[model samples]
Target: MTMGTAGLETQPSATTYELGDLVAQAWSGKVHVPHFQRDFRWTTKDVLRLFDSIVKGYPIGNLLLWVRRTPERSFTLGSLRIDAPAYEEAFWVVDGQQRITSLANALHPEGHLHDPFAVYYDLAERKFISQPKTREPQHVALPILFDLKRLLAWFRTEGEAVLHLFDEADRVATALRQYKVPAYLVRQDDLDVLTDIFDRMNNYGKRLNRAEIFSALYAGPEDGAEERLNLSRIADRLASRTGFGTIDTDTILASILARRGPDPARDIRNEFTSAGRRTAPEFENEDQDTAYAEGEEALVRAISFLQNEAGVPHLSLLAYRALLVVLTRFFAHFPAPEANTLRLLRRLYWRVAVSGPAVFKGSFTQVSRVLCARIRKGDEHGSVRGLMDTMAEAPRSLPTVERFRTNEAAAKIILSAWWSLRPRSLMTGEPYDAQDLSTLLGDQKTAATAAHVIFPRGLTAQQQLYAGNRIFLPTATDPVSEIPVMLMRQPIDLDDRTWDAVLASHVMNREATGLLADGDREGFLHIRQELIAGQLSDFLDRMAEWDYEDTPSLETLDFDNLDELEGGDDHSL
Candidate 1:
């Protein structure tokens, strides 16, 4: 199956296409974006940069197309959807889907302005801007800029205000029309060869991640497969099922590997093949269906344990994804371990969160191997013991949070601790909605998306990003970023008891609320920080207790005394 340059159906023909022509072709379904291609991942900034490069006459990268007939299907190219018709000799994009999607959607009149593609050309500044709400004289919407009739109409209106900007606008429009992207078209029948080419291109550039690469090899449905074992779809399914939020497929893949074997880094292309194992692969290398199915179910159970038993309500609050991977393997092997074992497992979770995966010493792959090797198929207590054995000592202090980051370990730990208090809205006595929390934090990998600044507009940079200054107020659609704290529209007329309850729910004492009401930002922060630290310490200490006096095994436990040992848990957090 080694793909060489030779065994191709059609010779490579490198040529250029008018930018506008390509956009038209894409809109009319002359070119097909394959399922193996990564999603339209470029941000508005990235799209603007691509446009900027074209305007400057810089060479954006060449596109690779495999010329063949593609069956019609409803698909998404960025936020735009196409219910395509079957086509003959449709050029299937083997590379550069990102650039194609950006150009097609940004330059099309019907492209959704709601998503980031709504671009505008700023004639005065000579730059591309994203979703300019202000009807500026110098700004021409990209959809209109690319259309001759619309461009002239725009000139008659907003353009009339700034007569000097016309020449620059005209120049940019011409550049948009004349812009050419170098593309290599190959008429190859064997999709395997195309996949190889695609892999080398994206892998070398370091664009697609490992899980994406793993999924690409099996990204069928071009010729019609029953269903796809898409990692993205699996993660999305889990997110929708539980309010715990979306987990990255890369982390999910680790869970899959943990169930299958000790080494998660083994080549996924050969996951169920002879190359992946010393012994013969189970089900004769056709266990992909079983493997992913079992893996996904186990992952669901692991997430339930995290949310229900460990007080970690969302994926964003889980300090380490590796912890989930480990739990996935444990749960996959033993669906319901004894109550004592479950309690010990919860303790192990907190220890790793406060300290880190550093509890297991090695590289990522190495740590995965070591942790996964500890789980046994039928031996529940032994598996729990192996994991608990890793945590030799509990962390004496709560994790420090110099800055608030959703994905970072320390910040996730802090957020999880605060979430245990079930932060209520200041205006309402109700607890923050888990659905709202999950929705806001779902797509974020940077600073906590669920977190917002308590103080509006007036804090220094250091004070603003300080971990203490951030709060998870999920119910607020629009944060009070513009108004002063005391001047905010949140009802200040609540009775003192109601105010006290609201303050308590936010992890703030009455003193902190009074300070905030009095315009004492410094005092408010200090008081809140102290209160948060105390609560966080108490929570961590409770989870750190290594209650290890259980019988040697699940069978060894005396049936009569079991109730006493598990009664205090009240069936967990």
Candidate 2:
């Protein structure tokens, strides 16, 4: 350690030391970890990589330690090689899961480092063996052996050659003990500083998902029958499940409101949590449960609509807000106490399919108004029934309703419509076409010659990494840190020039790019003629056929005969 400009004293950390030293100190009763810490489960490969880097003199990461005044009861660590007390007072390992485990394995007296270390070598006889007598038994590296007596005993029997082996092991251990991986030791008791440091460091550089980190921190219980009564616990679980990454806090609040509807508890929770939540600065305890229930109900309704009626294959981060809107309307007018009404929901779904995502996203206000209108007439909202029936009867396009695009309002209507119908092919402009995955992927390369290349500007690595196969905003650029490795999931043969040319062609045909205006999601479709032609050619050349278990059928729905459609199905309302 060295002092900075402030004259704060620090030790001159050695770059070389004995692993036995750390082991001895630990066995002497220095507990370095807490009970909540995960156990040592590193496989041979994981350990080997650490050693390999050490051999090359690469600096392994530092051990983050929370120093405490007193140590607690101890246990043997890492294959029972070393014993140490568990840290009980007020300290924990905030980072460095890998390096510390490696160190623990290397120096413990009881540890066996001689199981097997995997390395490939050509054999005189044409076969691979882990060692002289061993067949490849999950070739593992023996633990780092550092006991002086053990080294002496083996050396006396095996000669100077054995000494050389011990010497090499000692040297590596020495380097590990002395090598300093950067450690951030925080003093005083402030969880905020620790969390902020952990979050900012990881976010700015390593970049774990916000939900992932939150899951680690606040994760408590599942939102099943047993856990639903606890508001905080239920919210945490819902946030972990439905909330995508950074938007978790908001999603948790939204989920609650979706279940219970408008209430001031949201405001109080918001005060304790953070901004962007549906909570206010204060909420009355008496009203907390009602608000929480409303939120939860909203989420359930939205999820149902998306899964059953909208035919959304999977939920996406972008679609969350839209779903929230849908749930608001569903809970407002229907007596969902029984499964019978859900059956009728199927008939209502057809209207969703015909409406298209664009219309639903845009017409949220009108949908809510309609829901309210129907609620006044009867618990069985006939307005929704009428709307679906009317939309189904036509050689004409789906009816477009205009309304405010308030996030919540929009989500409710969109979800309701989505629940009522099966999703059609966005490409073919028809009901989903029956095709095998092989056929889909194979022809996908070239089958749709007329298909447009969406996201022509190019997809960023972060977007591609998280978005899976979904099309994203074309203008998005991946951060410099995430590239090549992140973007390798798809074929990379198409060059930038080709992408631009394809996009140019699509622009020419569609007039002004036809990019999603509100979402800034323009040029997402790959629609240029030449590009489609090239894709088709590739499909024909490289596509392979795969055997699938069962093919799904598209249901023919008659919205007018609601009772017939809703009543006959086992799962129907």
In terms of TM-score, the best-performing candidate is 1
- Superposed on all Cα atoms, the candidates' RMSDs to the truth, in angstroms, are 6.3, 17.6
What is candidate 2's CA lDDT for residue 162?
38
Prediction-by-prediction clash tally: 0, 65
lDDT of 2 by residue, 75-188 (tens): 545544333455444334555544555555444434433322332211122222233455332222233223444445544653334343454545543554554455555553
Summarize candidate 1's per-residue lDDT along 126-245 as a digit string, tens digits. 889887767678888898888878888888876888777778888899998899989999987877777777877777889889888877776655655326556777788888888777
TM-score of each: 0.84, 0.40
Kindly give the stretch of ten consecutive residues in candidate 2 with the minimal lDDT sum.
Answer: 543-552
Q: Estimate candidate 2's alpha-carbon lDDT, on a 0 to 1 scale.
A: 0.37
Model 1 quality (TM-score) = 0.84
